[model samples]
Target: MIVTADLAMSLDGYIAGTGVSPDNPGGDGAEPLFEWIHNLASWRERQGMTGGEENRDSELMREWFDATGAVVMGRMMFDTGEEFWGDNPPFRTPVFVLTHRPRPTLVKEGGTTYTFVTDGIHSALEQAKAVAGGRNVDIAGGASTVRQYLAAGLVDEMQLHVVPALLGDGLRLFDGPGLGPRRLEPVRVVDTPLAAHLTYRFAT
Candidate 1:
Protein backbone atom coordinates (compact mmCIF):
# COMPACT_ATOMS: atom_id res chain seq x y z
CA MET A 1 0.00 0.00 0.00
CA ILE A 2 1.15 3.50 -0.78
CA VAL A 3 1.32 6.33 1.73
CA THR A 4 -0.20 9.58 0.50
CA ALA A 5 -0.94 13.08 1.77
CA ASP A 6 -3.48 15.65 0.65
CA LEU A 7 -3.44 19.30 1.70
CA ALA A 8 -5.09 22.51 0.62
CA MET A 9 -2.33 25.09 0.68
CA SER A 10 -2.24 28.80 -0.05
CA LEU A 11 -0.26 30.37 -2.86
CA ASP A 12 2.37 31.48 -0.33
CA GLY A 13 2.73 27.80 0.85
CA TYR A 14 0.79 28.14 4.12
CA ILE A 15 -1.51 25.29 4.98
CA ALA A 16 -2.98 27.16 7.91
CA GLY A 17 -3.04 30.83 8.84
CA THR A 18 -1.62 32.37 12.06
CA GLY A 19 -3.25 32.31 15.52
CA VAL A 20 -4.44 28.74 15.16
CA SER A 21 -6.24 27.25 18.14
CA PRO A 22 -9.13 25.00 18.94
CA ASP A 23 -11.34 28.11 19.02
CA ASN A 24 -9.94 29.36 15.71
CA PRO A 25 -8.98 26.08 14.10
CA GLY A 26 -8.43 27.10 10.49
CA GLY A 27 -6.89 30.34 11.75
CA ASP A 28 -7.23 33.81 10.20
CA GLY A 29 -7.51 34.14 6.41
CA ALA A 30 -7.42 30.39 5.82
CA GLU A 31 -10.91 30.22 4.36
CA PRO A 32 -9.64 30.73 0.83
CA LEU A 33 -7.50 27.63 1.01
CA PHE A 34 -10.45 25.28 1.49
CA GLU A 35 -13.18 27.27 -0.20
CA TRP A 36 -12.78 25.05 -3.24
CA ILE A 37 -14.05 21.87 -1.61
CA HIS A 38 -16.54 23.50 0.75
CA ASN A 39 -19.35 23.30 -1.76
CA LEU A 40 -18.34 20.11 -3.58
CA ALA A 41 -20.95 17.40 -3.65
CA SER A 42 -18.51 14.72 -2.51
CA TRP A 43 -17.26 16.85 0.38
CA ARG A 44 -20.76 17.80 1.47
CA GLU A 45 -21.91 14.17 1.44
CA ARG A 46 -19.05 13.12 3.69
CA GLN A 47 -19.93 15.94 6.15
CA GLY A 48 -23.56 14.78 6.13
CA MET A 49 -24.64 17.87 4.30
CA THR A 50 -26.64 18.09 1.10
CA GLY A 51 -26.76 19.95 -2.18
CA GLY A 52 -23.36 20.87 -3.53
CA GLU A 53 -21.88 21.36 -6.99
CA GLU A 54 -21.06 18.22 -8.91
CA ASN A 55 -17.90 18.97 -10.82
CA ARG A 56 -14.28 17.95 -11.31
CA ASP A 57 -13.49 18.89 -7.69
CA SER A 58 -16.26 16.65 -6.42
CA GLU A 59 -15.02 13.79 -8.56
CA LEU A 60 -11.50 14.13 -7.23
CA MET A 61 -12.80 14.20 -3.67
CA ARG A 62 -14.76 11.01 -4.26
CA GLU A 63 -11.71 9.29 -5.71
CA TRP A 64 -9.55 10.16 -2.71
CA PHE A 65 -12.19 9.10 -0.18
CA ASP A 66 -12.66 5.80 -1.94
CA ALA A 67 -8.94 5.08 -2.22
CA THR A 68 -8.09 5.81 1.38
CA GLY A 69 -8.67 2.89 3.71
CA ALA A 70 -7.10 4.44 6.81
CA VAL A 71 -5.79 7.81 7.96
CA VAL A 72 -2.95 9.25 10.07
CA MET A 73 -3.05 12.72 11.59
CA GLY A 74 -1.44 14.83 14.30
CA ARG A 75 -2.91 15.39 17.77
CA MET A 76 -3.45 19.09 17.25
CA MET A 77 -5.50 18.38 14.14
CA PHE A 78 -7.60 15.89 16.06
CA ASP A 79 -8.21 18.24 18.98
CA THR A 80 -9.18 21.15 16.76
CA GLY A 81 -11.39 19.10 14.47
CA GLU A 82 -13.03 16.84 17.08
CA GLU A 83 -15.84 19.24 17.92
CA PHE A 84 -16.54 20.14 14.34
CA TRP A 85 -16.64 16.53 13.15
CA GLY A 86 -19.33 15.59 15.66
CA ASP A 87 -20.35 11.90 15.99
CA ASN A 88 -19.84 10.75 12.41
CA PRO A 89 -16.47 11.77 11.13
CA PRO A 90 -15.77 11.96 7.41
CA PHE A 91 -13.24 9.14 7.58
CA ARG A 92 -15.20 5.93 7.47
CA THR A 93 -12.05 3.87 7.93
CA PRO A 94 -9.75 3.63 10.92
CA VAL A 95 -7.57 6.60 11.96
CA PHE A 96 -4.33 6.64 13.92
CA VAL A 97 -3.44 9.87 15.71
CA LEU A 98 0.12 10.85 16.52
CA THR A 99 0.42 12.37 19.98
CA HIS A 100 2.72 12.38 22.98
CA ARG A 101 -0.03 12.02 25.54
CA PRO A 102 -1.78 8.67 25.71
CA ARG A 103 -5.51 8.38 25.31
CA PRO A 104 -7.94 5.52 25.05
CA THR A 105 -9.30 4.55 21.65
CA LEU A 106 -12.18 6.77 20.62
CA VAL A 107 -14.82 5.06 18.48
CA LYS A 108 -17.05 7.34 16.49
CA GLU A 109 -19.98 6.65 14.20
CA GLY A 110 -19.58 5.74 10.51
CA GLY A 111 -16.75 3.25 11.11
CA THR A 112 -14.24 5.87 12.18
CA THR A 113 -12.18 5.09 15.28
CA TYR A 114 -9.41 7.25 16.65
CA THR A 115 -6.49 5.17 17.87
CA PHE A 116 -4.05 7.42 19.63
CA VAL A 117 -0.42 6.55 18.96
CA THR A 118 2.00 7.93 21.52
CA ASP A 119 5.09 6.13 20.30
CA GLY A 120 5.87 8.07 17.09
CA ILE A 121 5.13 8.52 13.39
CA HIS A 122 6.57 5.13 12.46
CA SER A 123 4.46 3.29 14.98
CA ALA A 124 1.36 5.18 13.96
CA LEU A 125 1.98 4.37 10.29
CA GLU A 126 2.62 0.73 11.08
CA GLN A 127 -0.68 0.49 12.92
CA ALA A 128 -2.52 2.25 10.13
CA LYS A 129 -0.99 -0.01 7.45
CA ALA A 130 -1.86 -3.11 9.38
CA VAL A 131 -5.53 -2.20 9.27
CA ALA A 132 -5.55 -0.70 5.81
CA GLY A 133 -5.83 -4.10 4.05
CA GLY A 134 -3.71 -3.02 1.05
CA ARG A 135 -5.61 0.21 0.52
CA ASN A 136 -3.80 3.55 0.64
CA VAL A 137 -2.89 5.16 3.98
CA ASP A 138 -3.66 8.86 3.79
CA ILE A 139 -1.71 11.35 5.85
CA ALA A 140 -4.52 13.60 6.98
CA GLY A 141 -2.60 16.54 8.28
CA GLY A 142 -2.34 20.01 9.83
CA ALA A 143 1.02 20.76 8.12
CA SER A 144 3.30 19.47 10.89
CA THR A 145 2.17 15.89 10.57
CA VAL A 146 2.70 15.89 6.83
CA ARG A 147 6.13 17.45 7.28
CA GLN A 148 7.18 14.68 9.62
CA TYR A 149 6.22 11.97 7.17
CA LEU A 150 7.87 13.72 4.26
CA ALA A 151 11.07 14.22 6.24
CA ALA A 152 11.17 10.53 7.10
CA GLY A 153 10.62 9.63 3.44
CA LEU A 154 7.45 7.76 4.34
CA VAL A 155 5.18 9.53 1.88
CA ASP A 156 5.02 7.95 -1.57
CA GLU A 157 2.76 10.55 -3.11
CA MET A 158 1.38 14.00 -2.34
CA GLN A 159 -1.58 15.92 -3.72
CA LEU A 160 -1.66 19.62 -3.13
CA HIS A 161 -4.76 21.68 -3.76
CA VAL A 162 -3.08 25.00 -4.45
CA VAL A 163 -5.44 27.88 -3.75
CA PRO A 164 -5.00 31.35 -5.19
CA ALA A 165 -5.04 33.32 -1.94
CA LEU A 166 -1.93 34.01 0.09
CA LEU A 167 -1.40 33.97 3.87
CA GLY A 168 1.57 36.18 4.72
CA ASP A 169 2.32 34.29 7.94
CA GLY A 170 1.15 30.92 9.07
CA LEU A 171 1.99 27.21 9.06
CA ARG A 172 3.69 26.34 5.81
CA LEU A 173 3.48 22.91 4.21
CA PHE A 174 7.18 22.86 3.33
CA ASP A 175 8.57 24.93 6.19
CA GLY A 176 11.52 23.98 8.42
CA PRO A 177 14.52 21.88 7.37
CA GLY A 178 15.24 18.29 6.22
CA LEU A 179 12.60 18.22 3.44
CA GLY A 180 14.70 19.06 0.38
CA PRO A 181 16.18 19.16 -2.09
CA ARG A 182 14.22 16.10 -3.07
CA ARG A 183 12.84 15.68 -6.55
CA LEU A 184 9.13 15.35 -7.24
CA GLU A 185 7.79 13.88 -10.50
CA PRO A 186 4.56 15.46 -11.58
CA VAL A 187 1.72 12.98 -11.82
CA ARG A 188 -1.38 15.03 -12.61
CA VAL A 189 -2.79 18.54 -12.66
CA VAL A 190 -6.44 19.53 -12.76
CA ASP A 191 -7.03 23.24 -13.00
CA THR A 192 -10.30 24.67 -11.79
CA PRO A 193 -11.68 28.09 -11.00
CA LEU A 194 -11.21 27.69 -7.25
CA ALA A 195 -7.87 25.88 -7.12
CA ALA A 196 -5.32 23.87 -9.07
CA HIS A 197 -5.06 20.22 -8.12
CA LEU A 198 -1.44 19.16 -8.34
CA THR A 199 -0.31 15.60 -7.73
CA TYR A 200 3.29 14.45 -7.48
CA ARG A 201 5.24 11.34 -6.68
CA PHE A 202 8.61 11.36 -4.94
CA ALA A 203 11.36 10.65 -7.44
CA THR A 204 13.47 7.71 -6.50
Candidate 2:
Protein backbone atom coordinates (compact mmCIF):
# COMPACT_ATOMS: atom_id res chain seq x y z
CA MET A 1 0.00 0.00 0.00
CA ILE A 2 1.20 3.49 -0.75
CA VAL A 3 1.25 6.35 1.73
CA THR A 4 -0.10 9.72 0.62
CA ALA A 5 0.01 13.18 2.15
CA ASP A 6 -2.89 15.31 0.97
CA LEU A 7 -3.48 18.87 2.04
CA ALA A 8 -4.73 22.31 1.03
CA MET A 9 -2.46 25.30 1.46
CA SER A 10 -2.40 29.00 0.67
CA LEU A 11 -0.37 30.40 -2.19
CA ASP A 12 2.08 31.66 0.46
CA GLY A 13 2.65 28.00 1.50
CA TYR A 14 0.80 27.88 4.81
CA ILE A 15 -1.40 24.92 5.70
CA ALA A 16 -2.64 26.78 8.75
CA GLY A 17 -2.25 30.01 10.69
CA THR A 18 -0.99 30.93 14.18
CA GLY A 19 -2.80 30.94 17.55
CA VAL A 20 -5.08 28.02 16.68
CA SER A 21 -7.94 27.52 19.06
CA PRO A 22 -11.11 25.48 19.44
CA ASP A 23 -12.80 28.48 17.89
CA ASN A 24 -10.21 28.85 15.11
CA PRO A 25 -8.68 25.49 14.26
CA GLY A 26 -6.81 26.47 11.10
CA GLY A 27 -5.81 29.53 13.10
CA ASP A 28 -6.32 33.19 12.21
CA GLY A 29 -6.79 34.27 8.59
CA ALA A 30 -7.09 30.72 7.34
CA GLU A 31 -10.80 30.54 6.65
CA PRO A 32 -10.41 31.53 3.02
CA LEU A 33 -7.82 28.82 2.47
CA PHE A 34 -10.40 26.02 2.39
CA GLU A 35 -13.30 27.86 0.85
CA TRP A 36 -12.63 25.97 -2.33
CA ILE A 37 -13.35 22.45 -1.12
CA HIS A 38 -15.73 23.50 1.61
CA ASN A 39 -18.02 24.96 -0.98
CA LEU A 40 -17.97 21.94 -3.27
CA ALA A 41 -20.98 19.72 -3.88
CA SER A 42 -19.05 16.66 -2.77
CA TRP A 43 -18.19 18.42 0.45
CA ARG A 44 -21.83 19.18 1.14
CA GLU A 45 -22.83 15.61 0.39
CA ARG A 46 -20.19 14.36 2.80
CA GLN A 47 -21.72 16.61 5.44
CA GLY A 48 -25.15 15.05 4.79
CA MET A 49 -26.33 18.24 3.13
CA THR A 50 -27.91 18.98 -0.24
CA GLY A 51 -28.14 21.63 -2.92
CA GLY A 52 -24.69 22.43 -4.28
CA GLU A 53 -23.25 23.03 -7.71
CA GLU A 54 -21.41 20.32 -9.61
CA ASN A 55 -18.08 21.11 -11.21
CA ARG A 56 -14.59 19.78 -11.81
CA ASP A 57 -13.65 20.75 -8.25
CA SER A 58 -16.47 18.70 -6.78
CA GLU A 59 -15.66 15.80 -9.07
CA LEU A 60 -12.05 15.84 -7.92
CA MET A 61 -13.25 16.02 -4.33
CA ARG A 62 -15.24 12.84 -4.86
CA GLU A 63 -12.21 11.08 -6.31
CA TRP A 64 -10.01 12.05 -3.37
CA PHE A 65 -12.59 10.91 -0.83
CA ASP A 66 -13.12 7.60 -2.57
CA ALA A 67 -9.43 6.71 -2.82
CA THR A 68 -8.59 6.88 0.91
CA GLY A 69 -8.80 3.80 3.11
CA ALA A 70 -7.24 5.06 6.33
CA VAL A 71 -5.71 8.24 7.73
CA VAL A 72 -2.90 9.38 10.02
CA MET A 73 -3.09 12.79 11.60
CA GLY A 74 -1.60 14.96 14.33
CA ARG A 75 -3.18 15.82 17.68
CA MET A 76 -3.68 19.43 16.75
CA MET A 77 -5.86 18.50 13.80
CA PHE A 78 -7.92 16.23 16.01
CA ASP A 79 -8.38 18.63 18.93
CA THR A 80 -9.12 21.64 16.79
CA GLY A 81 -11.41 20.03 14.21
CA GLU A 82 -12.92 16.97 15.87
CA GLU A 83 -15.98 18.62 17.27
CA PHE A 84 -16.54 20.60 14.12
CA TRP A 85 -16.68 17.30 12.26
CA GLY A 86 -19.82 16.47 14.21
CA ASP A 87 -20.30 12.85 15.23
CA ASN A 88 -19.31 11.55 11.82
CA PRO A 89 -16.15 12.89 10.25
CA PRO A 90 -15.88 12.99 6.49
CA PHE A 91 -12.98 10.51 6.66
CA ARG A 92 -15.31 7.52 7.09
CA THR A 93 -12.30 5.34 7.82
CA PRO A 94 -9.86 4.40 10.55
CA VAL A 95 -7.70 7.33 11.63
CA PHE A 96 -4.55 6.91 13.69
CA VAL A 97 -3.62 10.11 15.45
CA LEU A 98 -0.12 10.82 16.70
CA THR A 99 -0.13 12.36 20.11
CA HIS A 100 1.82 12.45 23.35
CA ARG A 101 -1.27 11.52 25.30
CA PRO A 102 -2.90 8.14 24.84
CA ARG A 103 -6.65 7.79 24.57
CA PRO A 104 -9.16 5.08 23.90
CA THR A 105 -10.41 4.49 20.39
CA LEU A 106 -13.30 6.74 19.48
CA VAL A 107 -15.97 5.36 17.18
CA LYS A 108 -18.27 7.85 15.63
CA GLU A 109 -21.73 7.40 14.15
CA GLY A 110 -20.44 6.74 10.67
CA GLY A 111 -17.63 4.37 9.69
CA THR A 112 -15.05 6.79 11.08
CA THR A 113 -12.97 5.59 14.00
CA TYR A 114 -10.20 7.59 15.65
CA THR A 115 -7.37 5.83 17.46
CA PHE A 116 -4.89 7.91 19.37
CA VAL A 117 -1.31 6.67 19.21
CA THR A 118 1.18 7.73 21.86
CA ASP A 119 4.06 5.58 20.72
CA GLY A 120 5.40 7.36 17.61
CA ILE A 121 4.94 8.13 13.93
CA HIS A 122 5.97 4.67 12.81
CA SER A 123 3.55 3.09 15.21
CA ALA A 124 0.73 5.26 13.97
CA LEU A 125 1.61 4.54 10.35
CA GLU A 126 1.79 0.82 11.00
CA GLN A 127 -1.61 0.77 12.62
CA ALA A 128 -3.08 2.88 9.87
CA LYS A 129 -1.58 0.71 7.15
CA ALA A 130 -2.70 -2.51 8.74
CA VAL A 131 -6.25 -1.31 8.90
CA ALA A 132 -6.01 0.16 5.45
CA GLY A 133 -5.20 -3.25 3.97
CA GLY A 134 -4.36 -2.86 0.29
CA ARG A 135 -5.84 0.60 0.04
CA ASN A 136 -3.85 3.82 0.42
CA VAL A 137 -2.95 5.30 3.81
CA ASP A 138 -3.58 9.03 3.81
CA ILE A 139 -1.54 11.45 5.88
CA ALA A 140 -4.16 13.94 6.93
CA GLY A 141 -2.58 17.08 8.25
CA GLY A 142 -2.07 20.26 10.16
CA ALA A 143 1.34 20.99 8.53
CA SER A 144 3.48 19.43 11.27
CA THR A 145 2.16 15.95 10.62
CA VAL A 146 2.71 16.17 6.87
CA ARG A 147 6.20 17.55 7.44
CA GLN A 148 7.09 14.59 9.67
CA TYR A 149 5.96 12.03 7.09
CA LEU A 150 7.54 13.90 4.19
CA ALA A 151 10.86 14.31 6.01
CA ALA A 152 10.93 10.60 6.72
CA GLY A 153 10.38 9.90 3.00
CA LEU A 154 7.39 7.73 3.90
CA VAL A 155 4.95 9.44 1.57
CA ASP A 156 4.55 7.82 -1.85
CA GLU A 157 2.28 10.47 -3.30
CA MET A 158 1.46 14.07 -2.44
CA GLN A 159 -1.61 15.97 -3.63
CA LEU A 160 -1.70 19.63 -2.78
CA HIS A 161 -4.66 21.97 -3.26
CA VAL A 162 -3.13 25.40 -3.63
CA VAL A 163 -5.59 28.13 -2.79
CA PRO A 164 -5.26 31.58 -4.29
CA ALA A 165 -5.09 33.37 -0.94
CA LEU A 166 -1.90 34.28 0.89
CA LEU A 167 -1.24 34.07 4.59
CA GLY A 168 1.52 36.52 5.51
CA ASP A 169 2.27 34.73 8.80
CA GLY A 170 1.14 31.32 9.86
CA LEU A 171 2.01 27.62 10.02
CA ARG A 172 3.90 26.95 6.83
CA LEU A 173 3.66 23.57 5.07
CA PHE A 174 7.41 22.94 4.54
CA ASP A 175 8.77 24.36 7.82
CA GLY A 176 10.76 21.62 9.49
CA PRO A 177 14.27 20.39 10.06
CA GLY A 178 15.86 18.25 7.34
CA LEU A 179 12.81 18.34 5.07
CA GLY A 180 13.93 19.59 1.67
CA PRO A 181 15.69 18.43 -1.54
CA ARG A 182 13.31 15.50 -1.77
CA ARG A 183 12.51 15.10 -5.44
CA LEU A 184 8.96 14.69 -6.80
CA GLU A 185 7.54 13.94 -10.24
CA PRO A 186 4.48 15.83 -11.25
CA VAL A 187 1.66 13.45 -12.12
CA ARG A 188 -1.35 15.67 -12.66
CA VAL A 189 -2.52 19.25 -12.50
CA VAL A 190 -6.12 20.48 -12.43
CA ASP A 191 -6.99 24.14 -12.33
CA THR A 192 -10.14 25.76 -10.97
CA PRO A 193 -11.15 29.22 -10.00
CA LEU A 194 -10.68 28.57 -6.30
CA ALA A 195 -7.55 26.40 -6.25
CA ALA A 196 -5.00 24.54 -8.29
CA HIS A 197 -4.93 20.81 -7.64
CA LEU A 198 -1.46 19.43 -8.06
CA THR A 199 -0.52 15.78 -7.73
CA TYR A 200 3.06 14.50 -7.42
CA ARG A 201 4.69 11.17 -6.80
CA PHE A 202 7.97 10.60 -4.99
CA ALA A 203 10.71 10.18 -7.56
CA THR A 204 12.08 6.68 -7.36
Candidate 3:
Protein backbone atom coordinates (compact mmCIF):
# COMPACT_ATOMS: atom_id res chain seq x y z
CA MET A 1 0.00 0.00 0.00
CA ILE A 2 1.11 3.58 -0.58
CA VAL A 3 2.13 5.73 2.37
CA THR A 4 1.69 9.42 1.76
CA ALA A 5 1.53 12.55 3.95
CA ASP A 6 -0.25 15.67 2.74
CA LEU A 7 0.02 19.04 4.51
CA ALA A 8 -0.25 22.77 3.92
CA MET A 9 2.75 24.78 4.99
CA SER A 10 3.67 28.44 5.36
CA LEU A 11 6.55 30.01 3.46
CA ASP A 12 8.55 30.12 6.68
CA GLY A 13 8.26 26.35 7.22
CA TYR A 14 5.51 26.45 9.83
CA ILE A 15 2.53 24.15 9.67
CA ALA A 16 0.15 25.70 12.17
CA GLY A 17 1.59 29.18 12.73
CA THR A 18 3.05 30.08 16.16
CA GLY A 19 -0.25 30.25 18.04
CA VAL A 20 -1.48 26.71 17.37
CA SER A 21 -0.84 25.64 20.95
CA PRO A 22 -1.62 22.10 21.93
CA ASP A 23 -2.66 23.47 25.33
CA ASN A 24 -5.64 25.80 25.64
CA PRO A 25 -5.81 26.33 21.90
CA GLY A 26 -5.69 22.61 21.35
CA GLY A 27 -4.52 24.10 18.05
CA ASP A 28 -7.57 26.30 17.65
CA GLY A 29 -6.07 29.77 17.31
CA ALA A 30 -3.89 28.45 14.48
CA GLU A 31 -6.83 27.13 12.52
CA PRO A 32 -6.79 30.04 10.10
CA LEU A 33 -3.09 29.61 9.32
CA PHE A 34 -3.71 27.14 6.52
CA GLU A 35 -6.69 25.00 5.38
CA TRP A 36 -7.88 22.84 2.45
CA ILE A 37 -9.93 20.06 0.78
CA HIS A 38 -13.10 19.80 -1.39
CA ASN A 39 -16.28 18.13 -2.64
CA LEU A 40 -16.82 14.52 -3.77
CA ALA A 41 -16.87 13.13 -7.28
CA SER A 42 -18.76 10.21 -8.71
CA TRP A 43 -16.31 7.31 -8.51
CA ARG A 44 -18.07 5.63 -11.40
CA GLU A 45 -17.53 8.51 -13.81
CA ARG A 46 -13.75 8.62 -13.37
CA GLN A 47 -14.11 12.30 -14.11
CA GLY A 48 -11.76 14.31 -11.91
CA MET A 49 -13.38 16.53 -9.25
CA THR A 50 -11.90 18.77 -6.59
CA GLY A 51 -13.21 21.60 -4.38
CA GLY A 52 -12.55 24.14 -7.09
CA GLU A 53 -10.23 25.36 -9.78
CA GLU A 54 -7.84 26.16 -6.95
CA ASN A 55 -6.34 22.69 -7.21
CA ARG A 56 -4.73 23.46 -10.56
CA ASP A 57 -2.10 21.18 -9.11
CA SER A 58 -4.45 18.39 -10.08
CA GLU A 59 -1.62 16.09 -11.10
CA LEU A 60 -0.61 15.01 -7.59
CA MET A 61 -3.99 15.69 -6.02
CA ARG A 62 -5.67 13.39 -8.47
CA GLU A 63 -2.94 10.82 -8.03
CA TRP A 64 -3.52 10.92 -4.28
CA PHE A 65 -7.26 10.38 -4.51
CA ASP A 66 -6.91 7.60 -7.06
CA ALA A 67 -4.19 5.73 -5.22
CA THR A 68 -5.55 5.97 -1.70
CA GLY A 69 -7.55 2.92 -0.56
CA ALA A 70 -7.02 2.83 3.19
CA VAL A 71 -6.28 5.81 5.40
CA VAL A 72 -4.26 5.62 8.63
CA MET A 73 -4.65 8.86 10.55
CA GLY A 74 -3.65 10.35 13.88
CA ARG A 75 -5.97 11.22 16.79
CA MET A 76 -6.61 14.81 15.77
CA MET A 77 -7.91 13.61 12.43
CA PHE A 78 -10.44 11.24 13.98
CA ASP A 79 -12.24 14.04 15.79
CA THR A 80 -14.92 13.82 13.07
CA GLY A 81 -14.51 17.55 12.89
CA GLU A 82 -13.67 17.50 9.18
CA GLU A 83 -17.31 17.27 8.27
CA PHE A 84 -16.93 18.06 4.57
CA TRP A 85 -19.84 15.76 3.81
CA GLY A 86 -21.86 16.53 6.90
CA ASP A 87 -22.28 13.83 9.62
CA ASN A 88 -20.54 11.31 7.36
CA PRO A 89 -17.12 11.71 5.79
CA PRO A 90 -16.53 10.55 2.24
CA PHE A 91 -13.88 7.91 2.79
CA ARG A 92 -15.56 4.53 2.30
CA THR A 93 -12.72 2.25 3.31
CA PRO A 94 -11.51 1.42 6.77
CA VAL A 95 -9.61 4.32 8.40
CA PHE A 96 -7.24 3.25 11.17
CA VAL A 97 -6.84 6.16 13.56
CA LEU A 98 -3.69 6.23 15.70
CA THR A 99 -4.00 7.39 19.26
CA HIS A 100 -2.27 6.84 22.58
CA ARG A 101 -5.35 5.75 24.54
CA PRO A 102 -8.27 3.54 23.64
CA ARG A 103 -11.56 4.82 22.32
CA PRO A 104 -14.72 3.39 20.84
CA THR A 105 -14.99 2.83 17.11
CA LEU A 106 -17.06 5.65 15.67
CA VAL A 107 -18.81 4.58 12.50
CA LYS A 108 -20.22 7.25 10.23
CA GLU A 109 -22.59 7.19 7.27
CA GLY A 110 -20.17 7.41 4.31
CA GLY A 111 -18.43 4.17 5.32
CA THR A 112 -15.59 5.84 7.22
CA THR A 113 -15.05 4.95 10.88
CA TYR A 114 -12.87 6.41 13.58
CA THR A 115 -11.21 3.21 14.75
CA PHE A 116 -8.80 4.35 17.42
CA VAL A 117 -5.60 2.31 17.67
CA THR A 118 -3.65 3.05 20.84
CA ASP A 119 -0.76 0.84 19.81
CA GLY A 120 1.13 3.41 17.67
CA ILE A 121 1.53 4.32 14.00
CA HIS A 122 3.14 1.01 13.09
CA SER A 123 0.25 -0.96 14.46
CA ALA A 124 -2.08 1.40 12.66
CA LEU A 125 -0.08 0.85 9.47
CA GLU A 126 -0.39 -2.92 9.87
CA GLN A 127 -4.13 -2.69 10.25
CA ALA A 128 -4.39 -0.34 7.32
CA LYS A 129 -2.29 -2.62 5.17
CA ALA A 130 -4.54 -5.59 5.89
CA VAL A 131 -7.58 -3.71 4.70
CA ALA A 132 -5.73 -1.87 1.95
CA GLY A 133 -6.38 -4.72 -0.54
CA GLY A 134 -3.16 -3.98 -2.45
CA ARG A 135 -3.97 -0.31 -2.82
CA ASN A 136 -2.14 2.62 -1.27
CA VAL A 137 -2.35 3.24 2.49
CA ASP A 138 -2.41 6.97 3.19
CA ILE A 139 -1.01 8.45 6.39
CA ALA A 140 -3.57 11.16 7.08
CA GLY A 141 -2.33 13.12 10.07
CA GLY A 142 -1.22 16.08 12.20
CA ALA A 143 2.61 16.02 11.82
CA SER A 144 3.63 13.81 14.77
CA THR A 145 1.93 10.75 13.37
CA VAL A 146 3.46 11.43 9.97
CA ARG A 147 6.82 11.82 11.66
CA GLN A 148 6.32 8.45 13.34
CA TYR A 149 5.93 6.73 10.00
CA LEU A 150 8.68 8.86 8.48
CA ALA A 151 11.16 7.95 11.21
CA ALA A 152 10.43 4.31 10.51
CA GLY A 153 10.66 4.94 6.73
CA LEU A 154 7.14 3.56 6.39
CA VAL A 155 5.95 6.47 4.27
CA ASP A 156 6.69 6.07 0.57
CA GLU A 157 5.49 9.34 -0.85
CA MET A 158 4.87 12.86 0.44
CA GLN A 159 3.12 15.79 -1.17
CA LEU A 160 4.04 19.11 0.39
CA HIS A 161 1.46 21.85 -0.15
CA VAL A 162 3.53 24.97 0.16
CA VAL A 163 1.31 27.96 0.79
CA PRO A 164 2.48 31.54 0.54
CA ALA A 165 2.51 32.71 4.15
CA LEU A 166 4.78 33.01 7.13
CA LEU A 167 4.19 32.26 10.80
CA GLY A 168 7.95 32.31 11.61
CA ASP A 169 7.44 29.50 14.16
CA GLY A 170 5.00 26.92 15.42
CA LEU A 171 4.63 23.16 14.97
CA ARG A 172 7.22 21.82 12.56
CA LEU A 173 6.14 19.13 10.14
CA PHE A 174 9.04 16.90 11.17
CA ASP A 175 10.83 17.13 14.49
CA GLY A 176 11.78 15.19 17.62
CA PRO A 177 14.57 13.32 19.47
CA GLY A 178 15.13 10.37 17.14
CA LEU A 179 14.71 12.05 13.77
CA GLY A 180 17.69 12.39 11.48
CA PRO A 181 18.14 13.37 7.83
CA ARG A 182 15.43 11.94 5.60
CA ARG A 183 16.25 13.10 2.08
CA LEU A 184 13.49 13.95 -0.37
CA GLU A 185 13.64 12.77 -3.96
CA PRO A 186 11.62 15.20 -5.97
CA VAL A 187 9.13 13.58 -8.33
CA ARG A 188 7.00 16.42 -9.66
CA VAL A 189 5.85 19.96 -8.94
CA VAL A 190 2.75 21.93 -9.84
CA ASP A 191 0.79 25.05 -8.89
CA THR A 192 -2.51 25.27 -7.07
CA PRO A 193 -4.58 28.37 -6.44
CA LEU A 194 -3.91 28.35 -2.70
CA ALA A 195 -0.46 26.77 -2.78
CA ALA A 196 2.19 24.94 -4.74
CA HIS A 197 2.13 21.13 -4.62
CA LEU A 198 5.49 19.44 -4.48
CA THR A 199 5.77 15.67 -4.68
CA TYR A 200 8.74 13.95 -3.13
CA ARG A 201 9.63 10.31 -2.71
CA PHE A 202 11.44 9.53 0.51
CA ALA A 203 14.83 7.94 0.15
CA THR A 204 14.57 4.66 1.99
lDDT for 148 in candidate 3 is: 82
Error of 1 at 34 (Å): 1.5
Q: What is the lDDT of residue 159 in candidate 1?
A: 96
Provide backbone clash counts, one per model.
Answer: 0, 0, 2
Let me know the TM-score candidate 1 reaches against the reference structure: 0.98
Q: Could you give candidate 2's per-residue lDDT for residues 72-120 as a string of tens digits?
A: 9999899999989989789888999999988899999779999999998
lDDT of every predicted structure (CA atoms): 0.93, 0.89, 0.68
For model 2, the superposed segments whose C-alpha errors exceed 4 Å read: none
- What ranges in model 3 sit over 4 Å off? 18-51, 58-60, 80-86
Q: Report the number of the highest-TM-score candidate.
A: 1
Error of 3 at 95 (Å): 1.3
| TM-score of each prediction | 0.98, 0.96, 0.79
Order of candidates by lDDT, top first? 1, 2, 3
Top candidate when judged by lDDT against the true structure: 1
Sort every candidate by TM-score, greatest first.
1, 2, 3
